[model samples]
Target: MKVLVTVKRVPDPETTIRVKSDGSGIETDNIKYVINPFDEIALEEALRIKEKLGAGEVVLVSIGDSVVTEQLRTGLAMGADRAILVGCDQDLDSLAVARILAKIVEDEGPQLVLMGKQAIDDDANQAGQMLAALLGWPQATFASEVVLSDDQQAVKVTREVDGGLETIGFALPGIITSDLRLNEPRYASLPGIMKARKKEIKEVAAADLDADMSPRLTINSLEPPTQKEAGKKVETVEELIGLLHDEAKVI
Candidate 1:
């Protein structure tokens, strides 16, 4: 079972985001960066699967610039065998990003592709699905649990939907996007960190993929949202009702 995990370098969730002056995208300068939290769980799941089988390789793949190596190293530290970096400068939509990953899948020829449900920055939950479509393979999104089935040719996946859980049996050579409940990501020990530097990180350029990297949509401009006016304090239920009926026009 050769597992390929797709991870991302996302801005730290705690960082204050500011849209770029030209409105093309968000300003990334000086912001702290980290591996996408959900991708960490996906990596964890991949490691667990490989550990259980006691065989196969866990390959981490990401599409980004030089800084993304640190994020990929996080997966290597957690037990991935190796990594592939598709160096894409600027930003890419989920569609273009998935295309690059699909190329890596062809190069690596992994039996499974694991990734986070969505990256925290864009919240575009489309990469895995797009990759599956691009590869013409089956996909299971929002998978909370995954168990190998009877013959190791299939996987029993339990996914979380609105209000409940759903199960599906998918064949191997598929993609799965993991949710938060999957597992807690392990921290890289000092030794693991040192060893990660030695692990192989194969980098490739976007132009080499023979794909155009153009945005289909253009952003006009971006500005801070208008501040909301403070409402009058209501001391009693009657006052609240009055305010709702008149000032807020709720009633």
Candidate 2:
């Protein structure tokens, strides 16, 4: 069983984000970067699956500039057999990213492709489905649990739906997107970090993938959200009622 896990480099979730000077995008300067939380969960799930099989490889793949290699290394330290960096300097839409991943999937021919349900930065939950569509493979998104068949020919997945959990099954060579409750990600130990430094990470340019890397959407401008005014205290119930009826108007 060969598994491909997709990871992403994103701004630290704890930091405050500010729009760029020209309102084009967020200011990444002086900001810390880390692997997407959901992607980390995906990696953890893939590593667990590989360990259970005891005879398979878990490869980590990321799409971005050289900076993304840091996140890939982190995945390697977490027990990924190898890593691949899709060198794409420009910002790509979810569809374009899926196309690139599909190209790699064609080349690698993994039995399963696991990734996050959405990237926190954009919150676009479309890559996994788009990749499945591009590759003509079955897909199960927002997977809370994944169990391989006894024969290892298929996988049963429990998904987190709107009202309740939905369990579904898919044959091999499919894609599964990890949800938040899938698993807890483990921290890379010192030995693992040292080993990851020695592991080979192959770099492949986006152009080499031969996929259309054009953007289908554009952001005209990014504006900061309006700040709310401070609230005033009402000393009496009658005063509050008067304010609600005259100014607040909720009543």
Candidate lDDT (C-alpha), each: 0.88, 0.93
lDDT of 1 at 15: 92
Window of ten residues with lowest summed lDDT in model 1: 211-220
TM-score result, candidate 1 = 0.89
The prediction achieving the highest lDDT against the true structure is 2
RMSD of 1: 2.2
Q: After superposition, how far is residue 247 of candidate 2 from its true place, in Å?
A: 6.9
In model 2, which residue pairs have backbone atoms overlapping below 3 Å? none
TM-score of each: 0.89, 0.92
Which numbered prediction scores highest in TM-score against the true structure?
2
Residues 1-251 of candidate 1: C-alpha lDDT, one tens digit per residue: 89999889989999998888777768878899998999999999999988888898999988888988988888888889899898888678888888888888898898899999999977889989999999999998999999987567989889999999999987898999999997888888888888888999998898899765677645577776667998677689998999889888989
Give the range where candidate 2 is weakest over 10 consecutive residues by summed lDDT: 217-226
Report the C-alpha displacement of residue 4, candidate 1, in angstroms: 0.8
